[model samples]
Target: MPIIVNLDVLLAKRNIKSKELAKIINITEANLSILKSGKAKAIRFSTLEAICEALSCQPSDILEYVKEKE
Candidate 1:
């Protein structure tokens, strides 16, 4: 996927567990894992807001665009 999820990096930097972030973001641990693993196809704005709020970070910190190699 050209879109990369940098959530794990941020989570580690903040010393937060996936389950803890899931609870704070009001999402299931599975869903959080999906997002964290870059398996999610899409993310809602509300969900993004919740994640940002819980992580004290911006959307850019979690989502990044990577150029695909041709």
Candidate 2:
């Protein structure tokens, strides 16, 4: 996938655990784990907003686009 999920890295840099973030964001730990593992196919705007709010970060902090070389 071109879009890489960097949630784990940001969480680590911020010294926050997955369960802590999930609790603060009101999301299930399993769902957060899926996202952290980059196995999520899509994310809701509300969920994204909650994550950003809870982590004190922006969407760009969690999501990155990598262009493939042809």
Candidate 3:
């Protein structure tokens, strides 16, 4: 996928655990795992907002786009 999920990096930088982030965002650890692994097809805006708030980060901090070489 061109879009890369960088949730793990952000979590590590903030010294926050995935389980704690899940609780703060009111999401299940399983769901957060799916997102962290870049398996989620889509993310709700509300969920994104919650994550940003919990991590004290911007959306760009969690997501990135990389052009694939052709």
Candidate 4:
């Protein structure tokens, strides 16, 4: 997966716990964990909006694309 989820880094930078973020975003911890771990196949725009709103950041701040080494 070339797409990286920077949720954990953002959380750490903001001094927010997963539980707190999940609660704010109205998502379960398990689901949040999946997103953070880059195991989620997709994410909803509304969910992304909520995350950005809560974290005071943008989609680019949470997601990054890296080229895979061949």
Best by lDDT: 4
Predict model 3's lDDT versus the native.
0.97
What is candidate 3's CA lDDT for residue 42? 100
User: Please, what are the lDDT tens digits per residue for candidate 3 over residues 4-66?
Assistant: 999999999999999999999999999999999999999999999999999889999999999
In candidate 3 the C-alpha lDDT for residue 38 amounts to 97
Cα deviation of 32, candidate 2, in Å: 0.3
**Alpha-carbon runs more than 4 Å astray in model 4:** none
TM-score of each prediction:
0.96, 0.95, 0.98, 0.97
Which pairs clash in the backbone of model 1? none
Q: What lDDT score belongs to each candidate, Candidate 1 first?
A: 0.94, 0.94, 0.97, 0.98
Q: Candidate 4: lDDT over CA atoms?
A: 0.98
* Pairs in clash, predicted candidate 4: none
| Positional deviation of residue 14's Cα in model 3 after best superposition, in angstroms | 0.5
Give lDDT: candidate 4, residue 38: 99
**Where is model 3 more than 4 Å wrong at Cα?**
none
Model 4 C-alpha lDDT per residue in residues 1-70, reported as the tens digit of each score: 8999999999999999999999999999999999999999999999999999999999999999999999
| Candidate 2 residue-wise lDDT, 19-53, digit = tens | 89999989899999999999999999999999999
* Candidate with the larger TM-score of 3 and 4: 3
- Predicted candidate 1 versus true structure: per-residue lDDT over 1-70, tens digit per residue: 8999999999999999999999887889999999989999999999999989988999999999999999
